[model samples]
Target: MLLRMPTSLSEAQRYLAEGAVPVGGATLVWALWQRDGFPEQAMSLRELPEATLIEREALGAAVLLHQVDDRVPDVLRRAASTVGTGAVRRTATVGGNIVGSTLRCLLPAALVLDARATVLDREGPYETDLAEVVAKRHLLLGLRWRDPVTSGYYKAPGEAGGPPPLVVATAVHTGSDGRHRLFVAVRDGYDVISETVPCHTGPDRALEALDDTGLGSLPAEAREAVRREVTGILGGPADR
Candidate 1:
């Protein structure tokens, strides 16, 4: 297999247009190649200096998971830390974690942050929401977000360190007019089954809003556990 390292986005796009699969960190690609053989061509984004940068409000797609541990917001940092062990974290890129994995820890936090991704297609670089880019299977160039007032993420992993069964992320941001905007995203395995509900009052009201969603359909014990975990992070009424 031919490996082409592109130093610029345009160069990468040209390779991609010719059907070269983009690779960052190679964690996911290597796994697939082990079973299915290498692709005809592989475009490596690692040589692009911009692809690994971690700016104040933007994270390059090739930025390693461990690179985000102390540099990003607490919620994002916490989520990044949960991804496998030291070796895996050191080699896994943010884009791979988001677009390659079926269920990712970083995505819930990205959802609450209202993150947008810059992607390259044959048309050129375009921006879209993270979810949209993932759904369209676009090549993510980078991720950007605005600073939030407060944010938190929680995930309940499956047994034997498997994929998480429940993941919840919440963020509170104040608009220009000083009104607060609250967002909550819930994901279960492959399902993004919950919607963001407005919490006009406070964290207590946020917990109350959960009942209006499919969260109420969960077993009583599981529902309560989720509530308590969210409450512990956001400081709501834990008993509720």
Candidate 2:
């Protein structure tokens, strides 16, 4: 297979424009090979500096998962650590983590962060939310977000070293007037089955808003378990 390393963003864009499949860490490449055959041409994004940087609120697409564990917010760091073992973490890129496996550890955290992505296509770089990027199957160049006041993540693994059956992420921001904006995303396996942004004054009220979204759709036991897990993370129910 032809492997080309592009040293600049524009160069990478040209290669992608020419039909070269962009490769970050090759984690996704290998996974795809197991299902289909190898791709004809792969352009490596490792040489592009923008692909590996973690600037204030922007995360380059190719930044390694371990780098995120070391540099991002606590909630994201915790989520990054759950991605894989030490060795796997070393090789997996944040972009790969997001695009390669929907059920992986980063998506829910990014969702809670209200993250947006910059992507490159035939026209050029464009900005869009992570959800839109995923839906359109675009090539992600970077991620950007503003840190929240408080955030938490919880995952219920299906097995010892496998993808979780359920993953939940919550972020809360408070305004000066004492109102709170709570964002929550619940992923059942590979899909984010539910998402809600409810304005509330306390944890109990926030959860009550979530309940109104039909959390009952999940199995009764699973729903209760997730509730308990999230409650523990946010601290025992308390008044704002």
Candidate 3:
């Protein structure tokens, strides 16, 4: 838990950035070494500053979220198997995925929640929109997504031992506090941002929302909506 509070990417770059080397989770470190050689520093982010959700710019990185999303479901299983096999995903970092501008499984889920990454900087804690943060090479440790939002993830794998060609994500849910968030993600470099009226009360509201989205339309295709491939009877990708 080495706590590092870099005010901006420059600071992050200078502090952790070594030569032309990429830094994040151990995977990146080893990857660089695999291609080049050992790193000057084995930087640790476990004790890094907390993400301050200021201005909705706290959407850290795909690699970071990928490593932390522990929800049990077929979608998760599919995502875990998204790129490479178990050994690969195990070393992949959600932050690195996003930072490298590579398409990842978590993008769709993050987009749907209209999620924001909370940041904790020198001036205190603030929030940043995930879109803006990833716009450049910003160093992100963690994220804070608004709770109770309904969302889903989709992945298209490539080759048997590679990564998914693309991952589509959508989040739609009504918070207990009376707020609705609609998030959508497409491709590796682009994302769609939209807002929908509050349409849920919680997980229990699944039935009502599904009805509105077209329960009959569910299990139809992985187009854009809710598809529960994770043992979730509705619309979802194939359970891996």
Candidate 4:
């Protein structure tokens, strides 16, 4: 395969449109081989402009997000490690997979909160919903949002020797207006979205209930069961 390193994402996109696949810093040939065969182009994103927040904004009634940072979120890169063994982790990137919208990837983590992405659309620096941007395969510049309450992530193993990922659960919470903004994220096959609640509740009870529903295949019956089990053990504030 031929390697053509581009100085920017636009260059990479041009390469992709010209019948060459963009590749980042990872072991492209090996990662590609594990999936199919060889890649057409090995592209580099190091020189590409990084993402940063421009300003902080209120998400709902309760959350406040940091405006900007020149670096990628550490939690995102950490989450990518869940995809596979050391080989995959060595080369994977947070913005890379997130731009690609890999299920069980960083995008899900950000999506669970008040975060939103700002990208240059045909009009200009357009603010796109994370879910919508991923759906249309649009380019992502960066994301900004106030972090919610405590955040949790869970990963599962897949079949031996494959590129597929198995991540069961992810959640984020922040209290506002006397209510805990609860969000539960789960990956189903190829989709990752959150179930959020912005209402008053005991943090202890919420945390306890959340503990019981630990990752993977929790249907309605199971969700309720966990809720019940956790309530008993959880030391929570009495409802007003």
lDDT of each prediction vs. the true structure? 0.75, 0.72, 0.45, 0.48
Candidate 1 at residue 106, lDDT? 82
Ranking of predictions according to lDDT: 1, 2, 4, 3
lDDT of 2 by residue, 1-240 (tens): 688788877788788877888777887678777689877888777777877777646788888888875356556776887876788888888887887666656887787777888888878788998877777777788888876667777777667656566777776656457666766767776667545544555557667767777565776765776577556645643311
What TM-score goes with each of the models?
0.87, 0.85, 0.55, 0.58
Write one digit per residue (lDDT tens) for candidate 3, span 14-111. 55544333355565456557778664544434334442212232333323333543343223333445655567576566566555544545545554
Off by over 4 Å in 1: 161-163, 218-222, 233-240
Task: Assess the local accuracy of residue 189 in candidate 4 as a C-alpha lDDT between 0 and 100.
Answer: 51
Worst 10 residues of 2 by lDDT: 231-240
TM-score for model 4?
A: 0.58
Q: Write the candidate numbers in order of decreasing TM-score.
A: 1, 2, 4, 3
Residue 50 lDDT (model 2): 72
Candidate 3 residues lying further than 4 Å off, grouped into runs, are: 1-22, 29-39, 47-81, 119-126, 160-164, 175-181, 188-240
Task: Give candidate 2's error at residue 121 in angstroms.
Answer: 0.6
lDDT of 1 by residue, 161-230 (tens): 5656677777766666677666666676666654455555655777777777777676675576657755
Query: What is the overall TM-score of model 3 with all chains considered together?
Result: 0.55
Residue 55's lDDT in candidate 2: 62
